[model samples]
Target: MLLAIDVGNTRIKAAVFEANTLFDAFIFVKEEFAEKIEIILQQHPKITTMVVASVGNLDPSAFSSFEKRTKIEFISHKTKFPFQNLYATPNTLGIDRMVLAAGAVLQFPKQNRLIIDAGTCITYDFVDADDRYLGGAISPGITLRYESLHHFTAKLPLLTKSYPENFIGNSTTESMHSGVVNGVISEIDSFIENYKTRYAKFIIILTGGDADFLAKRLKNTIFANSNFLLESLNQTFQYNQK
Candidate 1:
């Protein structure tokens, strides 16, 4: 068994994998990570190797407990990836995005892929058919948009994201919903359109916290999987071994 951990901006998502199949999964806040991992370890002592990918400033001590039982691999720019990274500032690339790009290549090979991860922030990462990690864009995520409005202004109340009934919102809360939700949909669609113009045939893989909410709303066809990063972490682990 393999243990995979993806520490994102807000949460730490961990999974136990038997080869490519997911055995079990759990998520917790960053502060609770060490305790959660301890529980997971107690439950699955057979996990021989662990791979971690983080975009947050997680303390290394949190993972120190795994040293005795599992071989830990924390992904970094130095880590071997399946694809050639062409980003100008390679060192500055987020490990989460790198893992997602690697996941795209592993999941759907020999094709142009655009991976949209909608978590704390929305990130678009592209990997061409030739297996080159071409850079993509990033924008404010659904929650961030709502929070930004409230944080930046005094009167606007902080609202949770929801699917608006119409583009023309009737109420104050609905208007915020319309702007954030529909605006994201439009932004994603526009990115897809622009990518299509450049690449004749490609696949869009949408995965993240808000993937389910945005999947049906998207005009472009996409393969949505919320646990993509974890899966990719496992794949990267296997690839690293080879």
Candidate 2:
């Protein structure tokens, strides 16, 4: 069994994989890292390796205690990926994005892929049919947009994400909702449409904390799996072994 961990900007997501099949999954804050990992390892004693892809501040030393039991592999630019990275600043590419791109290339072979990760920041990554990791765009996510409005403006109140009933918001709160939520949807749809114009055929894979919320809202058809990163981490590890 393999334990795949994704340390994102806000929380840690983990999953146990038996071969390529996911057996169990977990989500917790960094504060509970030690306890949660111990519980997970206890529950799944067969796990012998733990693969991590971190885009956060958590130090690897937190996993020191588990070193005796499970081999630890951290994804970095030096790690062998399934695809050729064509990004101008290859080393600067986030490990999470690289894992996602590798997952796209490994899972959906011989096809163009667009992966949209809507987390702290919405990220767009494209891998062509030739398995080249072409760079994509990044934009503010829903919560960031909400916070931006409140932080930048004098009167705007901080708010959570809410779907607007209409594009033309009736009140201030409704308008903020429409702007933050619908605006992101529009931005995503526009990006997808733009990509469609350049590529005749490609698959769109949406993953991240807000993937489920935006999946139905997106005009373009997409394969939305919030756990794609974790699955990709497992796949990337398996690929490295080969």
lDDT of 1 by residue, 1-242 (tens): 99999988888899999999999999899888878888998999899888899898798778787798889888998999999999999999999999999999998999999999999999999999999999999999999999999999989999998999889999999999999999999999999999988999999999999999999999999999999999999999888888
Cα lDDT tens digits, model 2, 87-128, are: 999989999999999999999999999999999899999999
TM-score to true structure, per model: 0.98, 0.97
Span of ten consecutive residues with least summed lDDT in model 2: 158-167
Q: 101, model 1: CA deviation in Å? A: 1.0
- Screening candidate 2 with a backbone cut-off below 3 angstroms (N, C-alpha, C), the clashing residue pairs are none
Per-model lDDT? 0.93, 0.95
Model 1 earns a TM-score of: 0.98
Q: After superposing candidate 1, which stretches have Cα over 4 Å from the reference?
A: none
Model 2 stretches with alpha carbons more than 4 Å out = none
